[model samples]
Target: MQQVVIIGAGMGGLAAALRLQAHGFDVTVLEKQPRPGGRSSVIEECGFRVDTGPTILVMKDAFEDTYRAIGENLNERVEFVRLDPNYRIYYHDDTHLDLYSDPAKLAEEVERVAPGSGAQLARFMADSAAKYALGMAFVERNYTQITDLANPVALRRLLQTRAYQNLYRQVARAFGGSDKLAKAFSFHSMFLGLSPFEALAMYSLITYADLALGMWYPLGGIYRIVEDMLHLAQQMGVTVRTNAPVEQICIEAGRVRGVRLASGEEVPADIVVSNADLPYTYRHLVAPEHRRSYPDARLERMDYACSGYLLYLGVDRTYPHLQHQALYFSEDYRANLDAIFRTRTLPDAPSFHLNVPTVTDPSLAPPGHSLLYVLAPMPNLTAGIDWEAAAPVVREKLLAQLERIVDPDIREHIVWERDYRPTDFLHDFNAAHGTAFGSLSHGFFQSAYFRPHNKAPDVDGLYFVGQGTYPGIGLPMVHISSRLVTERILEEWS
Candidate 1:
């Protein structure tokens, strides 16, 4: 049996481990974190359970297919509840919108908010569905080379998808150029750490998935998915070792030999898979001379995704107005996005994703208490902001904003509090430029075959599975990436 070593027990790595193990490889997963679920890990504080990363799970088919590959039922292992009115959008106009998965209800809401929009909403859904179908087909598979872009069939499909239009434009045209509704639809790009104005129009597929497929929550929390994956991995006889930070990917004459842990233990393997942040992986783990394609200067020149400022609070009281997920848009949405991605500065008025998980899964908090997760998109570490000095000020402002928006005197009721900065993402996960998600933003040039391939260009027996590689970010995308990578490995080994 061929020995395989996977670095970073993220969702992608765990999934790859299971798939590769089933393929008859001896698989061992090494994680720097104390536990599994790289970005999807849970943070426990004073009995309050909060998912520090990836609060929502979308695209059920990808998740279902993953478990089905091993003849296991994901539903049986983890309870999934579909979220209707997926998210409550609190706009800058003091008006709120509830995004429903049901088309009829959504049309009604659109018509109510913006007159004569019911028909437009229907048309938008139909067009978005087409984009979703095309986009998923394009992303779910692997991209081996740049020439794959020139494939006639792929080009035809791409042209038909109108991927050249850009997401904000597509959404604006879909909603009769209504900025508010457009923003609601197009903002899904931010989930991938890309600005709607700049991210490919193909990404409108995200909004389609959310509004059409509906959002979902596991019974225990998002981290429950991680726990379940870990359980499945262990049951399959895959060795999973946590707190085993990989110091380097041991390469011998341009081929993977194994990995060296920070503890000075070297684990030998026939193949190495990395689910760590891509830029960081190439720059830090793989030695400079051995790297043929990604040199230090080239890695530094790459455009990375924006980071986030996260605030997790275990509050004594629940806000009745809060839903499972809510987003409070900054007054000037475009300007804030510019600040994060273009100017590389903190948003003076930050738009935030507010998740009150206790509303959906009350067990996450004690009786009468709630868990609030606030994530504000900010520039990555490249911005040079003094996080240690800025965190306290930002925390006060954020708490005040929450109080003003949701509850008065909300801060007084907080029983527990913790915050994660961009630097924390860098120090903890080796995330490039302190990006909380994964690799570079999904720009047109930075996406699809243009993104890093699962199989390294020059390194034999080395693979990558995670947000940095093809079929980029989001839990579903990572799942897809893992499957694609495992399939490649199986093919090569067979």
Candidate 2:
């Protein structure tokens, strides 16, 4: 078997190890952190379990594909409980719009909200579904070199996908004047760190993924998926060594041979796949001469996804009316987005995503208690905001923001609380400039064929996976990225 060394035991790295191991590669996963799962990790504090990041689940088929490829079935291992109302969007005035999984019920709700909106929603769903299908196919086809996509037909199809139009414009065209409908559909773009007005219309496929595949959650928590994937990787005989930070990718001539750990120990392999942040890998892991094409000058010009300021709270009391998922939008959504993306500062009134697991799975908390993850999209550290000064203020602001939209007496009911700022993401993940979700802005130059390469430009036999590369951010896309890279590795060794 060809030896494959995967750097980083993140979701992408773990998934890649599973796929490549099945393809008969001897895989060894090296994680710098003591634990696996990367962002979807769990922390226990004061006898309360806190899941710090990545709350909701979407694109169920991706997990199914991963297991099936390994001669196993995902549903057989983990039961995915389909969430009926995918996410309940709580408006500023305390009223809500439930974005449901069932199309008929969703349309019924649409009709209730705006006359004749059901028909518009139908058309919108149909178009979004097509985009999702086409997007997946095109996204998976590797453009290892930008010139690989010079074919005119591929170019035309790419343009036709509205990779050019802004997501907000597309939503406004379909759901005009209905602010609630527009906000509900365009909200996921926040994951990409783009305001609906700035993010690509191609992201409209988020609608299809949420409504069609159905919103879901593992029985325990999002972190359970990580544990499951880790279990599967280990079962396949892949050795995952944690707290093994790689100092550099040792390149001989023009190809990658292996990596040197920070401890001065060398772990050699025939091939190396980096699940690290792409920009960080280019800057730190690889030497300066090897980075001829992917230079800091060009990288500086690229738009980075926003970082997150998160608070993981273990509440002492139950929020009976809260759902599993909710978006607490402060008034002036556009201005708030502008403050984060454009101004690169905390907004006067920021919209936050809240995950109340107790509402859906009471087992996550002690009886009559809750767990909440409050996340806000802010510009990466590139904006140069003073996080030390802002972390506490932001945390308090999020609590206040949650109070306005959800529970009025939120602080009084708090059992335990911990907050994460951009600094934490940078320090922990080596995330470039504390960027939250990696390379996700869907700007003109940031599109697929233009995003970070799966294969390193300078070093041979060095490939990339996860949020920074093609197929982009979110759990499902990263899973697909792992699949694509493993296929390439299989072909290369064969």
Candidate 3:
């Protein structure tokens, strides 16, 4: 049997282990944290269990595919609840719009926001559906060379959909120049840590995937999927070790030997797959001589995704009126985005995502209580903003917004509270630049074939999986990445 060692037991790592083990390889998963699930981990306090990252789940087919690859059924293991009116968009002028998965209901809501724009939305979705189909053709496969991505058929589809254009411009034009509708639709790109104004129109596929494919929530939380995968991997004879931080990837004669753990233990393997942040893996784990392809200079020059200020609160009372997911857009959406992406400064009025999972699963919190998870996109550590000082200020601003929008005196009902900052991301996950989303941003040059390949270019027997590699960012994309890397490994090593 071929021996395989995977670093960081994240969603990508755990899923890959299951697939590789099913193929008769000896797989071992080492996690730095005490628990599995890197960003998708959980936070428990005062009888409230909250997911630390990725509250919304879309493109569930990707997840189902992962399970089917291992000869298991996803629905049989994890319970999924579809969310209606996926997101409630709260605007600056005290107006709100609900995004629904049902086409007829969505059309009604779009018409409510921008009259006579229902037809325009239908057109936009048609284009979005095309983009999704075309984009997934590239996303679901492996890329060995640039020609694999820029071939004749792909180029023709790219031109046909005009997916190379700017995302915000396309949405704005499709909505007949309605800024509200444009922002509401294009904001999906922000999850990838790119401003819609700057991201490519191909990203509108995210909006289509969310609305058309529908937004789903696993009953226990997003972490429940992680738990299930970990359980299955262990049952399949994959050894999982927590609190095992890898200090270095040992390479000799241009080939990976194994990995050195923080405790001075070395584990040997025929191959090593890293689920760590790509830049961090290159910079910190691989020695200087072994990483000619990704020198420190090139890593520094790479664009990283924005970080986030996360506030988790377990309140003593529940607000039944709040939806499972909601978003608050600042009056100056452009300025708000500029503050994070361009200027790398704090916004005067920050936009935020609010999630009250107790609305969907009250069991997450104590009886009759609620759990609130607030995330505001902020500049990554490159901005040099002192999070120790900025966290309190950001928390106050978010609470103030919550008080005004959701419930009055919201702060008073808090029984437990905790916050995570950019520094925490750096410390906990060793994420380069303390990026909260994927470490690498999804710029035009940093996507698809342009992104780092799953197999290492310099070192033999070293590979990468997760958001930092191709098919970048988001839970669904990470699941796809796992399969891509697993296939690559099997083809080469099996």
Candidate 4:
């Protein structure tokens, strides 16, 4: 058996390990953190168990495919509760809208918010469905050359669906120029760390996937998926070692030798797969001379995704009125996005995501208590903002907004609180630019065939599996990335 060494036991890394091990490769997964799940880990304090990373799951078919690849059933392992009214969008005017998975219900909700928009929404979803079909054709494959993506048939479909248009404009035009509906739908691109105004219309595939396929949460929290993957990987004879940070990828004679741990131990292998932040792996783990395709200068020029300021609060009081997921859009949505993506500064009034997991699963916290996960998009570390000084002010702003939208007495009910900043992402995940989502913002050039390939162009036996590679960001995309990379490895190494 060919020995394989995988770095970072994240969702991508863990999933890749399982597939490789099931195929009869000897695999060892090394994680820097004490526990598995790099970004998809958990935090437990004061009787509160909160997921530290992704809160909800969408495009669940991608997840099901991963487990099925290893001859395991996903539903048999994790209990998932599909959320109704996927999200409650709180507008600046205090009027709210619920986004439901059922088409009739969603149409009703849209008409309630933007009168006469029900018909427009139907047309928009049809266009979005077409975009999803065209986009996924490229997303589900590995690109060996530009022709794989730029072929005539694909180009024709791209123009026909107008997938090349700007996302915000497409959604606005679809909804008869209703800014509220546009904001509600187009904001899905933000999860990929791209501003809707700048993202390509093809990304509406995300909006379609969210509404059509539905949003789901595993009963125990998002961490439950990670825990299940870890357990399954171990059962398959895959060795997983935590607290083993890889300091360098050892390459000699233009081939990967193995990895050098931070503790000075060398684990030799025939192949090495990295799930670390792509740019970080290239910049820190791989030596400069070996990075012909991604030199320091080129890496610096690459656009990174936006970071976020996160607050995980364990409240002593339950919010029965709160939906499982919610969002608050600032009055000036464009200005808010511009601050994060253009000027690279903190917004005066920020839009944020609110996740109340305890609303669906009371087990996440102690009896009579609830957990609040708040996230506000912010500029990446390139902004050079002093988070130490900015965090307190941001925290105050978030709490005040919560008081207004949820309850006036919310401030006094806190039992435990934790704040995560871009710097924390840097220190913990070695994420390039401390991006809270995945690194590498999804721009026209940074997506599809333009994204980094899984295999190294300069060094042999070196590969990458994660958001930094193609298929890009989100838990679902990362899962597909693992599958794609596994296929590449099997074809090449076989």
User: What lDDT score belongs to each candidate, Candidate 1 first?
Assistant: 0.87, 0.81, 0.92, 0.93
Candidate 2's residue-wise lDDT over 254-281, tens digit each?
Answer: 9988899999999888899999888888
Worst 10 residues of 1 by lDDT: 148-157
User: What does the lDDT read for residue 125 in candidate 1?
Assistant: 77
Q: What does candidate 3's lDDT look like per residue over 1-494, in tens digits? A: 88899999889888888988999989999889998999999988779999999899999999999999999999999999999989999998999999999999999999999999999999999999989988898899898988897667767778988999999998999999999999999999999999998999999999999999999999999999999998898789999999999999999999898899999999998899999999999999999888888999999899999999999999888887789999999989999999999999987789999999999999999998999999999999999998888988999999999998877888889999999999999999998988998899999889989898899999999999999998989889989999999889878886
Model 1 alpha-carbon drift over 4 Å, by segment: 150-157
lDDT of 3: 0.92
Residue 405 alpha-carbon offset, candidate 2, angstroms: 3.1
Ranking of models by lDDT? 4, 3, 1, 2
lDDT of 1 by residue, 1-494 (tens): 99999999989999999889988999999999887898898988787999998988889888888899888999888898898889888887778888899888888778777899888888777777877877766687777666666656556756876877878987888788888898888899899999998888888889999988878999989888888888888899999999999999998888999999999999999999999988888889988887879999989888899899999999898777788998988789899999999988778888999999888888998889999999999999999999999898778878877886778878789899989999999988999999977768887777888887888877899899999898988899988988999889988888
Per-residue C-alpha lDDT of model 4 across residues 1-494, encoded as one tens digit per residue: 99999999989999999999999899999999899988888998889999988997999999999999999999999999999999999998889999999999999999999899999998889988888888888899998998887766667778887998899998999899999999999999999999999999999999999999899999999999998898898789999999999999999999999999999999999999999999999999999999988899999999999999999999899888999999999889899999999999988998999999999999999999999999999999999999999999999999989998888998888889999999999999899999988999999898888999999999999999999999899899999999999999999999
Badly placed stretches (over 4 Å) of model 3 are none
lDDT of 4: 0.93
- The local distance difference test score of model 2 is 0.81
| Over 4 Å off, model 4 | 151-153
